[model samples]
Target: MSTLLPISAKTPAGRPRGDGAETAQGLTPAQMARRMAGLEGLVWLDSSRPGEGALSMLTALPCEVLAGRMDTDWQRVEEELEAGQKAGLAGGLFGWAGFDGRFVLGVFPHALVYDHDRRCWFDSGGLAARIPAVAAAAAGSVPRLDFSPQVRREDFLSQVRRAQELIAAGDIYQVNLAHSWQAAWPRGADALSAYQRLRRVSPAPHAAFLDLAGVTVLSASPELFLKMSGREIMTRPIKGTRPRFPGDPARDAASLSALLASEKERAELLMITDLERNDLGRVCEYGSVRVDGLWEVESFAQVFHLVSTVGGLLRPEVSHAAAFRACFPGGSITGAPKKRAMEIIQELEAAPRGLYTGAVGYFGFDGESRWSIAIRTAVREGERVTFHAGSGIVADSVPELEWEETLHKAAGLLAAWSLPR
Candidate 1:
């Protein structure tokens, strides 16, 4: 594992020093992100929703790129982050960690951080100076995408049945099964424009647009995987889901009620919640881990999810990497007995998940970090675009209904590309 040499002097905790002329100039984060499109190493951590204490961040021109495809590589990244923090380096590391240990992270010297609550942009690097020129440039059109499922309906159903069989044999209590879609990246469409369209239809609190060396990630994930502020850490896992009825209030309310009342839904969420608690216990101080919230319903533009919050204070000797290793690839996305569930997922799914169900976020040099579970996310590479949606298959899971649920979860991504469900 390579280490980051100390860069600039440290600023205050949680607050990076800006150029003192911070202003939005009446532009939204989305607009600013559009201006920054096509820039390599661009990372925009967007909070599409308002007033959640979440800040949108944009930064480019990485001083060092930290990328890896194995667990050892991830450990190196964690070590680099911890070393940077101890050395009092200014700035942060931003990028995504793919399912398993594959990741592409970068260390930036400055950034443009937007405070949603205050409705303004703070320029840490002098990079904010170019925003005016880019904003004045013409925004390009988004091309239409024709996406087709990589997994046939019959195959998906069979996979679900296999998962159920495993549960029957006590191999696992639950497993998350997924299918993917692929589309040719059209001539004129760009990652940022597609992300803009996606946010328009399905804005989320943990959304992001990350343009790396060879890959671009457009995510509108609603699940928080991990958050670290000093010694305190938290994880919010989403397990159960119900699609929303956009035009019919009565139908939507009924759907929400049914999700809340379903025994299967409740059981699914409880299993993951317990799994998260156990995961946290590994890195947190003894007796400090606890469930902050359980079996709560959170409504998004396209679906209603049963979410739970588990948190604890980290052990004094625990490093950020240690904390993440204890809880990577969140339990909500995998299932109970995570290792076995992932093994079954690999055996049954059509292809590797790549960035889907992975995590996207940042690790500040100040020891603060935040990451979101990469569901409802798309990855664009060269002329190809790929995304996946999944459902938790419990013992009583019906293959047909589970397939339907995957479609419901995929509705937002498809709608973003102007494709019919």
Candidate 2:
């Protein structure tokens, strides 16, 4: 059995003097995660890329569990968050919201926070003493994962063609289409080990690993969906992708130049940027919303992406629920003219996207929050592990190329699963 320790308000022993922060001596975030693996409600919002604000956060033994199924749940979650703030919990609330508005949230009283800026770990409670012993335990080898796509290639290409038809007919300008892959859970491999492998291969700015009661989430997403600090709100959306070629510098540079010069890619990013601006405008102070960054290329392990940043100052009267409701499913994943695109997607796709393209992050008791666009993510439930990849389809998109783009976007995840392209 794993140890569950409550956070001590007073600094515990073994902590360094003069601020109670301890430099990481024995356990890496992965090791700490392994120490608490299988603990219900364990949430790790891991910044696998260091020097990006918070290094990582580990919390388990939730004091309050919040869940909802319908759209109305947003209001309930907001209310619960406000109440949690009033109750003065030691730590924050963390969880994910699905694409369909279904969500599972948790408020933890104990936590282990690692601050990259400080180069130290803040132990909210007493779990540190129990972590180092388990750090040295060797992880089990990951076995081959025989993943099968839920959508056939021919069917996906046909769906892409249909979406192009819709664009041509003026039903929608752009739509994001996705398909899932599933594999039987290997008997000896655990979620922690898989996540460790994933982070090693695809270190991302917004990576995370979550172990809920019966569900496990492993994410290496590089897109930021929403961030709220005080009355300020911001979002970064990614729209274009080009695979990286590390062995060939000239090819890699050519890929970067090509991505920057593609009009189609620029158009795709612009549409989503506009959509995000509109969403923020709904709850933001008038004239405060602005595009902070546009058409910037961010390179990741497997690919390079065109990213844009939009932000605004929130209206004084806007509540957290209202802010979230205005922009629940991010525009980048939903496409331009959000509602209509989502309708088209629902009509075309085979299965519900339970967590893919959703938001995964935390709402702090301090009234701050950060969420990532849930791409490059996998979910483990019972004996099955499932994941999905998506691409934005436009009028000029070729069905074959769009299908290949999804595979490119899924390269890191596929590699983590130890599968070939």
Candidate 3:
């Protein structure tokens, strides 16, 4: 079992930090690793920053990192995870494994944790002692960077048309296609700062900053891939998008209203929503899977999305790994008839999606977890940063319109990277 410790009212980073609306501040995992030395496998999920919303942080290091391929026996992986949890693993596990481990399987971290929501910290041992300094440290500033689209507008349009042809042939109903934008940052670039700027412009409920070893992922996604509490599980998938007009209030309202009324967009969202229901039904208890919400338009900094919620009750015998595996690479991003859509995507897309379509969040030791669909996210390595944006394609979708939708989605992250510091 883990221990929950209380932190004194001492201010961190010179700010009067209390349990109020003050922005929660903490070091990025990379920043913490640099300062703490010997912290290679550290994992920290910080939401203490105000406006960033939640004031909770979960931090730890893995006793060992686990790796598996998409073809790896999921049953076995679930067994390992069950054993670890049964052993009373201390900290929650965090990961961004590709759609399947065909790319990589994320590892679980074990150590001290600070649960701001609970007003206490947890660790199996003395790891909780280090939370203070890590929380108190200041975040570095983001350096100015430049990004170039890997897929030119014309090329993206051509791909959209190709997808429509596939849909016309009755090959697939919808397929989500994406393009990448990349930049190279010199050492000392601040990913956390970039994430903060993104949140300021487009606050998302699923915003996350993940530092996995040397790689850091900054996301401002508005979609929830999965959320678990005991046997209840839910997924909120977003299928349609419309850019938010900032200059005119009347136009913005009309644009949102139009998006809400778009039959094509509603068709796109419903297809994915039904696909999600099927995916959830696989692992959920019999008759437990159902659509909770549908055709709801939610606004964000960059765009508005038609969102829906699908939920189910997990079987008593189902494991967390099983519940998540059934919904890997969220349906919102993959499109309807999940497998066929992925096949078309793999055939037409110029590059591997890597973590863009993956999920990020913590698999807690206490049988609860929260994961955000990894969209509107940037991945940073030493000096290079890459992120992607995509749109769903249905038979009636116009090539040029779908192309523009992707650009609208990419706008905020591009601004975050290109904006002058």
User: What's the TM-score of each model vs. the native?
Assistant: 0.92, 0.91, 0.85
Q: Which regions of candidate 3 deviate over 4 angstroms?
A: 1-39, 42-55, 73-77, 100-127, 132-138, 419-421
What number of clashing residue pairs does each candidate have, in the order they appear? 0, 1, 8
Off by over 4 Å in 1: 1-25, 125-132, 419-421
Instruction: Let me know the TM-score candidate 1 reaches against the reference structure.
Output: 0.92
Across 1-421, the per-residue lDDT of candidate 2 in tens digits comes to 0112222333455453322123333456776777666466779999898755655888787877878864766666777778766875456668888898788888776568766676556665454533443434467776568889899999999999999999989999999999999999977676788888899999998999988656788999999999888789999999998889989999999999999999999999999999999999999999999999999999998899999999999999886556876798999999778999999989999899999999898877666778999999999988899999999999999888888889988888888875655
**Ranking under TM-score, best-scoring first?**
1, 2, 3
Cα misplacement distance, residue 321 of candidate 1 (Å): 2.5
Tell me, by TM-score, which candidate is best.
1
Error of 3 at 351 (Å): 0.8
Global lDDT of each candidate: 0.83, 0.82, 0.71
What range of 10 consecutive residues in model 1 has the weakest lDDT sum? 1-10
Give RMSD (Å) of candidate 2 vs. truth. 4.0
Tens digits of lDDT, candidate 3, 1-421: 2233333333323344333112222433234433433344444444423242243444545555455564665565576667767876545556666653533234454443444355444333334344334334466676667888898888888889999899889999999999998888767665666766776666667776666656777887778899888889999999878888888889999889989889999988888889999999998988999998999877777798899999999999887777887679799999878899999999899998878988877676667677888898888877889999998998888888888898899888877668464
